[model samples]
Target chain A: MATRQYSFYPGCSSQKGASSSNYLTSVQAMCEELDIQLNDIPDWNCCAASIGYAGGGELPRLTLSARNIALSEEHNPGQEIVATCAACWLSTREAAERLHEDQSLLAEANQALAEAGLKLKNETPIKHMVEALIEDIGYDALGAKVKKPLEGIKIAGYVGCQTNRPFGIDGESYENPRYLDKLVETMGADSVPDYEKKVQCCGGALAFSEPEKSQEMVKGIIEAAYDHGADMIVTPCPVCQMNVEVYQDQINQTYGTKFKMPVVYYSTLMAVAYGRSAKDAALNGQVIPAKKLEAIAAK
Target chain B: MGDLNQAMIEKYRTNFLKEVEANVEEGEWVKMCMQCGVCSGSCPLGKFWDHPPQELFMMIRAGKRDEVLSSDSMWMCTSCYNCVVRCPRELPITHIMHGLAHYAKRLGLVPESQPTAAFAQMFWDNLMQKGRVNELKLGLKLYFMNGFGDGIKVALKHQKIGMGMLKTGRMSPMEAFGGHAVKDLKGFQSMIKKAQELEDQRIAEHGA
Candidate 1:
């Protein structure tokens, strides 16, 4: 295990908005506890996200994502880059996939990069931190690390479009799937089935594109989740977590629905379930009320 | 020389309900229709319609094409897929329903009470011209063609949304034509034509 480690890219949101950024501090603490070293790439930039390219063509999006990939390469060659933010994960994956698929495009992108004093060969594999954990570390072994084991609490997992779309990662299907729920169960909880609006986007770009539309979509998702009896929504992506949580107050007000859906990282949840203290995992920044979670945990 | 029972409606009895293409996942979707009537019960337009969802599936399988296509239920769907998710079997009911709607439109079997077919044609028109969907333009075009009241107000509201979208870089005017772009468009058209041909062949066989 000590023989391999990748440079981690936190992306823009991790540096600013998301609770998962603070969660990173706890993750670092946990990594220390687990004796794993994850080096952060220096002078890293944004992945430009899925929203940036929703209207724009491949050039701008690919260029933006490739710059970060280039930075990772400069810091640590011949090693993979692990991304915490879902948008970053998608962008990086897109860059890598696009660069690999079209040689001419790759040459052009590199030529554009040369102007910026950067080079991207498209060789590195960008893995979502969860993928690295579940695929690389294996579930049963991680299960051995669980000290608290969140037993009997009901949790529903939400993996937004970015984490699963554009289709390269091959472990699960985006629709009607059970992997995230299974991941939650691995942490020792019942994964509730809420099929309503499961595939609907939380309107990530719509927050910028059409704020009202964004609000409507957010309200719809929360209502659907609540109707299905999800005590809390656990997501692997930070944007999904942020949109679902930050907009909850707005959504509740707009739609007249009581939505107390706590958005949490699957890793943080696992860390807590395994008996790590809240400080040990940093669950404080979570948008969902911490006390409610404590009550669920205590039971 | 089989004796026909006067009480049994042969047309109704011919419907397997279970065998309908809509009932694709018989074990899952078929088993889950609790008949609690939440589907028919909760439907917003259920009271005004003659064939409820349960009956629609039955009609499709029974070859009661007239009843299924002529109903207002398909028009009122909104393509929300709410019923699909709520259904115990997860039958992709909305997808199946939309296919039936499209088939009805192509055959001119659609009722005048619903104009969903007109909407479909407008969507194609936008796609063919622009290579993408422009909801604002499409909506206005639709409203005008159908003589919908309050076109200006409706158009203005959507235009505001469209303007907002444009500002956010979520919606934009078509980009300047790039090298090899026309080739890509031609390839896409060919793919679409192949898909339509396949669909038409299937409908022909099924209708036969």
Candidate 2:
């Protein structure tokens, strides 16, 4: 297979020693197996994240992402910019879309960018890494590369919000996105295709600000996964992975329920299925360890 | 802040909806809502909210300016985009929610003790410092946001997780000194400053 290259934008969460640093690790491992080269956009800044609108307003928020897009255009020209973080992808893509649609906003954004020795061309295609995986590398090819099929494992594909709604993966329904399920099935796992809360919200950044409300939402997601008789849960978004995995202890205490389900990323699952070691798959990063997946990696 | 708030009230008079449409991002779409309750129903945190998205839009049209801006309902939005995709009228409900929240903050009407609003400010300050967020400082700041006593309790509660992350190299204590920064820090800060000035100017011109 020929090598595919993309300018990678690992957002704040995926930065070294940040919340989703493990995600970056597993993603790097997965890309190595898939023969994809991710060139880092030199000295990239935050995409203003989802909660940024409250402080950044519209134009500044747009400019923050526009700066990154401008830097990518200048440095990694002609390559599609891909983000591993869902919020990063959403904010950047939304900025590009809004800038393209509104020429006046584009001009204002460029005025800000000009101060930073940058310009908002709004020319590059912004994509989530999962979109690149599904569209660029089809399911058949992905499945063909699986060295060790994940047989006998019942996995529930949790297609949480951000990745599913607004601009979802190509040809996917907002409510019932089956791409995650298909990815699970391709890895030879028993996918719970009808996981009820697949598109449910894990409360995103509110997990820090309003723990009670966000935890309630997280409880629903994990409870639904357990109800489906699945051994583990998988998601593409960093916030989903962190919220669901790290909050189990608190949820168990708050709800008086014994919930210890391992919320792994789809990349982690793919890395393990592709015969990568547990370390390579970043299994140790899980707050609630996926013992079953770790055992699979050991095998 | 109070002067600007009062001026806006006097300008818009009894038309809160028009005020929002003129100033808020994607606020123009609020009129197309058609009173559909799908957005309210689709919200994961709808039950916890004092007024859901539908009710908020209704209140806006009713010209209940003080109640709408100080309600604290918009801050509850998680930006899940559930309401956006599910809205029958295709209202960009999520953006409107954030827009309302941002407008409220700008007018100095954010409800007292609003944690999300506080955290957003902290996150923004942290980001603008180095053009990137220092996770360690942000986490520490969040823990201590309420008070020293509350900060201690919350820090103690999450100590295990923090230690685990540190051990696994997912977080660094050294970041407290000075975390990663964009190479062109001068240019970045200047750009952000210029954008803020432009935005303020635009809002002032619109009000005038």
Candidate 3:
């Protein structure tokens, strides 16, 4: 068994019964089954999500994320920091890059860290769990682990904003990211090639604040998935899943349509394909339950 | 246009571009925008903004302080960074919009009844208080902060989502009633306090 180990940063969303708990649970199960050792960083704080960007100046937001980077450095020096939540991945990666680029900001952030007796080197590689899976564990090795190869289940690969914007996965087009599609295909599922809203924003943190606008964005994404004959939409971000899934009923009421599309994590599919049971994958926690996926896993 | 209004425009001293660049970290990068319409065009919500990104930058440069700050344009920015990646000048357009929103909030210029601005403030408050946000608390605070009637109306509308959250184990009963907070509250508070102090010191240097 090949062992891949790294510092795991589970953001606030990973707390018990939070929006991203299932994503965290499913990803953790998938990682364990795949032989990746994730050492959880002790006492990790919130990533300051979009609200940090919304209400505060740059230094405080950078400082908040820098503290996490500093902790990973202390606990698991030189090891890559892996995050399942897209917001956390974006926050940590963006902070490190900004600090690295601006010496003054780096000094300021470090000074704030000095108060906590921590100083960030900003050297640890921060990545989304998807990037680690694609780069570190190639799909062929992952493909070999599929005990129940997904068959006849058409999945729309929704790569939301953070994974590929500003800093994208290796060889990914910022405008049209295909890494998710390829992963779906490698898992023995049909990838919707012409999914237009694949790289579109699912209205991030604004889903709570501006419901009307966010619902429209979610409609565009989900409607496209349904229009393309997809049984389910698989994503890498927990926020996307929540925003996309939670808004469907309201969206349906508003638009006079019947769209109950299941928004699930890519790890959910990977776990099922890798021979993990549906319950272990946390599939039951899915908001709009995916009957097709569950039946395939059962087969 | 320059000949007719030069005196009138210059006399008002409405030019806020310099102040924004000096004071706001994200706003500093907006000075590089070359009036390329790419940002406006790339935005999903661009059509909704009264002043699209290109126009907003132009107005900012032209010293339209009241018009720029009071406009709903910044409030509507979803921070998708579509413009950030496509910008020829490498300007962080999304961040600039967000910075402008923060500036408006600081000045009490955000239009009343703007939920996004309200939600942003609530979100920050929760994070600052508990060191991390509890979803239920954040949700309740957001809907109810305005008034009881408004809260119930919004709650009734979103009840399905709430029930679904409970059903799926995504939100536990305890979490729904009372949400989770950071374990090491002291450490979290201190880090936030230190960051706030450093940020305040920097902002003060900008001469308010």
Highest-lDDT candidate: 2
The model with the greatest TM-score is 2
What root-mean-square deviation over C-alphas does model 2 reach? 1.2
Return the top candidate by DockQ: 2
Worst 10 residues of 3 chain B by lDDT: B1-10
Model 1 ranges with Cα > 4 A deviation: A1-4, A16-20, A54-57, A295-299, B1-208
lDDT of 3 by residue, A1-299 (tens): 43889899888877887877888778877888888989888767777786665566678788878888888899988789999888889888988998999999898888877877788888999998888888888878888888777888899999988887877788888888998888899889999988999989888887887788888999999999989999999998888889998889999999998999998899999988887788878888888998987886676
Worst 10 residues of 2 chain A by lDDT: A47-56
User: In model 2, what are the clashing residue pairs, if there are any?
Assistant: none
lDDT of each residue in A41-100, candidate 1, tens digit only: 765544545433212234434665676688778878877888877767766886788678
- What digit string (tens of lDDT, one per residue) describes model 2 on residues A1-299? 43999998988878878888999999999999999999999989988888887788899999999999999999999999999989999999999999999898899999999999998778999999999999999999999899889888899999889987799999999989999999999999999989998998898999999998899989999999899899999999999988888888888999998998988999999999999999999998887788888888999
- The local lDDT score (0 to 100) that residue B137 gets in candidate 2 is 97
Give me the runs in candidate 2 sitting further than 4 Å from their true place.
Answer: none
Note the Cα lDDT for every prediction shown: 0.57, 0.91, 0.82
Would you give me the overall lDDT of model 2? 0.91
